[model samples]
Target: MTELLSPTLGGAAAGLGVAMPMGAMSVLLLQEAMRHRRTAMAAAAGIAAVDLAYAALATGLGPWVASHIAPVEAWVRLASALILLGIAAHGLRTGWTAPTPPAAEPRGPATPTPPAFEERGPGRSPGRPAPPAPSGPARPAKAFARYVGLTAVNPTTALYFAALTTAQGASLATGAAGAAFLVGVGAASLLWQQALVAVGALAGARISDTARVWTFRLGYGLVAAYAIKIAFPLPTPG
Candidate 1:
């Protein structure tokens, strides 16, 4: 088992290589974390789960998947680009709307008092702001599902895993080495994704609402540019 540690270390490096890029999926994860900090762990778990699964597949059928996916890579890129654009548009739309506060009745005077906790709703408090509605989907489960699907469709992820596994000879890892390598990749990906979630939470806490909206707009623009580049890439000259 000690001898297999080398493979495990290699897998960790590969995970970092694949996950550290600033892409649309990463942007979405950060935005999701900022929106629902409590559920960010779940979203992070979803990210790791897909990574683990992909690592396993790469270990098992790396060569076959790599060769087969190359032919259809363009289609996958298009799909991912479209999904990113859709997410960007929806987020912009949601950001435009202001959160609605409960209407208040005048308390024996011309001025209206803000609604009390009970007046707002059950288990609600004046100190706490009303929760922002989720941008992509209504609930955490849906968000998790959305992340899993979106991340899976990213062609770069599959290509990354396929290349990494092939380079590391994952097909020959066998037994303990194989298991360790898979675990190592999963651990690395999980750690990085959770860190992103924490950073996003801090950003949400420290920044003003206007800053959040503007940052989101900036990210959306970048994602749109990436999508456009992927969708209509320039032709190579002979």
Candidate 2:
């Protein structure tokens, strides 16, 4: 059996190398994390699961898949590009049309404070502010489905790994090596994604209206650019 350390480290580094770049999926994941942490975590885990599966497939059956599914892969890439473009347009429209929060109503003297300090519940604090309520219900299933769909159909991920496996030349000894690689990749993905979640939690209070608007715009623009790149291909020799 191949040692775990080498494969784990190599796999982690390889996974990060592929995943660290900001892409449509990354943006969506981050946005979800910022919007709803628990659901985003589920979605992130789903994406990691897809990555592990892909890594195994690439390691075990790279050549056969690449040979038999070249045209299908091309179509998937085009479809992904179109999807990205649609998401970008939606983001832009949403940012432009987001509604302002309703104004707070004025308090009147008729509102009476009947309870004294002695009557307060054991767990309740008199002066401390209550924690903000959850924004809304979480859609973990839908989010997970979207994450899985994007990852399963992403051509860039397939192409990138195919290239990587080809370059590595099946240097792996057996399925054990592939398993180790997947473990490492999954660990790294969990670490990075959780880190993003932490950052989102920490920064949730500090993000301003202007910053939020611009962030959406930046994400939309990047997605649009990626779509354009895919839609307009470079000339190839016959």
Candidate 3:
């Protein structure tokens, strides 16, 4: 019971730790929530689903990677450190450049210009009719699938799960304990994602662009520090 409980707790902590960072993805989630509640909820679920998948995969793969890493431990660590540093650098760059959400769009009663729509035809002609604009709300299922792919492709997140799995030890990655851990990860991540969506839907406009920028910077800064720690390990006591 204790063994299972420990992994479950660890997985919950791991889930929150990974999901708490507010990056571009978080901003996008918030923005969508403000405009389309159903789509945003679906997206949040998709993101959590990906996290659960990554956690499960990591739980199974970490032990194998550790066993085989002895021959090239230094190289593997170096590579992992580099990957993390790259992610941090990209995050920092985007943090400065990422566009503010629609909430930050100029607030004044002015006629907004309609952007030009794309024309699909064999050739441009005066008689060619522009495609009709979409008249309905965004599809929730599409949002779900899109977010699932977006979350799945995030390398930093993948590495995070891998790190957590390796740290959790092989003993906890089997049978009931493993199942408990996966459940914890899924539940915690889903709850967090939903909370973000709710906040966006309820009061996203209250958040400032500066706050978003700083949040992104801070999250990536921590990642960079972790990468540095990995790159330069402390010497063990004799």
Candidate 4:
């Protein structure tokens, strides 16, 4: 492992460096922080896991995979773009149709009624309200699954690792050197993603109630924008 130090640090730096750019995934990370304040860690873990896996794949077998998959690159990009668009559309619909918080109950003579969904269950008093269901689908495991799926299909990630590994040539791509680089990548990726989660959570905390609602609406819009950008990138100059 000591011999691999150089490669590891190099890989880690590269991995962390590449991940710093803000994008659709960043939005989702921030969203998770805002929603499950406590579970952001889990989501971060998931993001890290995908990063490490991609790093390893890029270093270990990127050339072979890239070559074999080249034929279908366009399809993969299209599918990824479509998936993003679908998610954005669903979020937009859900946000639009979401019920407004019920009016704060007036204090005084009449007892206030609970929202229909929050009505008391068996063994509970009629007046007692049930716990509300989660506003979005962001359980830790689900968040993890989501990141894994999104990152897996992200062509840019695969290409980044592939380019880096291939650029190292045969000399740097083998044995202890290669191992070290992968290690570095994993470490760097872990650190960066966790920081993003923390930052997101902090942002979530600072936002006002009204801001939270608008933020959600804005996130959906941004995601849709990302999807459109992905699906229809501008043509390069001739």
Candidate 5:
């Protein structure tokens, strides 16, 4: 019990620490939350899923994975940077474009209705006001898949977990201890991501549409800057 508890707690702490950094993924998550809370949560789940998988891999096979990744770390970083830049470019493009207006109803529909009878759709009644239409489909599933792919491409995640496993001297722990650790990591990261999402949602509720657009632009700008930094990182002092 003690052994399992130790790894679990350690993993939780590590997960929080790693997730606290405001990387491109973080920016994207916040932008998503501001627009669609449900989609943001889905993206958060994706991030946590990747984090959990990485934690498990690191705990069980850190040395081997790290060794293999070391050979192409630069290429991986470059690829990640390119992907981020592409996402940022897309965001900027969409943000600048005017929203499409709803199309006019077709002219051929002229069904006669009785004066006394009211047409009520599902989950709606005669007295109650109709619920506001959704601005767009939440598309949470698509967001989940996109975020999962984005987070998976980030080499730093795997490397960071691998480093932690090596430092903790638990890289070979693949039994109950590792499982507990992974659960802790997933829970902690998910909680943190959700907290971020909540904050963004609240801010979105208070802001104007113009403000939201500017905020979205700022997020993509930050992501672009991060990508540039990753593509050409500063040299460390000797």
Candidate 6:
């Protein structure tokens, strides 16, 4: 048990180190946090749950997981690629239709009147209020499904853990150590993700509309790129 405790805790910390970077999922999570804190929390929890499941599967089943799960990885990659492409298309549409930034006025002579805020398009009634912003709690089911799908489709995540486990096979003794490592990794993941959600929620309030729009486009673009990389893996040495 004592031996397991150290390795498990160490593994957990290492897992956090690997996961802390702002990847596609992180960006998505941040975006969600900005839009809906509760939803973001649900999504983060789903991701962490999946990670723990994968970690346990990798640590315990090892090669068998690869053999059984590898086939599904292809379908998952395809689905993820399609989802990313859809998101990119949505971004492109939104970006194309987005209102252009008002040009700056000339400094000398006549001071130009600032463009009046248009609540609606031309011909619309001025008295009509703007559409209400979405304020309800995020849908837990949808958020969970989205994150779980993304995580499940991540090929690199599986490859990384597989490699790590294979290398550490000798050191991963059965009994308390194995259990401890799993617990540590799970705990670390939850802690790190929750922290990320909190930071994202706090920062979201300060984001400008233009900046938020651009971020959505950029984040989706990156996700599409990642999907492509996963779909068409680089050739390995024979």
| Residues 1-238 of candidate 2: C-alpha lDDT, one tens digit per residue | 4376776776776565444433334444544555668887877777777767777777676535445555554444455456656655655664545442222112322212111211101112223332222233358887677667656765545544444443333444456766777787678766765665565555543234465456556545654564555443432334
- Candidate 3 lDDT over 41-121, as tens digits, reads 998999899889988898888757766665555455566566666766765665455433334222333212211221110
Q: What are the models' TM-scores? A: 0.54, 0.52, 0.64, 0.53, 0.54, 0.53
lDDT of 1 by residue, 1-238 (tens): 6787877875675555445433334545555565566576677777777878888887777445434566554455465456545544644554444342232221222222221211110111124332232344236676677567655654545644554554334233476776777888799878978887887677643223455456446544544554464455433334
- Model 2 TM-score, all chains together: 0.52
Q: Taking the tens digit of each residue's C-alpha lDDT, what string does model 4 give over 47-121?
A: 677767766776777445434555554444455456545554654454344333333222333222213321110
Give RMSD (Å) of candidate 3 vs. truth. Answer: 9.3
Stretches of candidate 6 off by over 4 Å are: 63-137, 205-238
Worst lDDT 10-window in candidate 4 = 117-126
RMSD of each: 12.8, 14.4, 9.3, 12.7, 14.4, 13.5
lDDT of each: 0.54, 0.52, 0.62, 0.52, 0.57, 0.53
Arranged by lDDT with the best first, the candidates are: 3, 5, 1, 6, 4, 2
Can you give the lDDT of residue 124 in candidate 2? Answer: 20
**TM-score of model 1 relative to the true fold?**
0.54
The top-ranked prediction according to lDDT is 3
Clashing pairs in 4: 7-180, 7-181, 8-180, 8-181, 8-184, 12-184, 12-185
Error of 5 at 4 (Å): 1.9
User: How well does model 6 score by local distance difference test?
Assistant: 0.53
Candidate 6: C-alpha RMSD after superposition: 13.5
Give the total clashing residue pairs for model 4: 7
Q: Which structure among the candidates has the greatest TM-score?
A: 3
After superposition, which runs of candidate 5 have C-alpha atoms over 4 Å from their true positions?
63-138, 170-174, 205-238
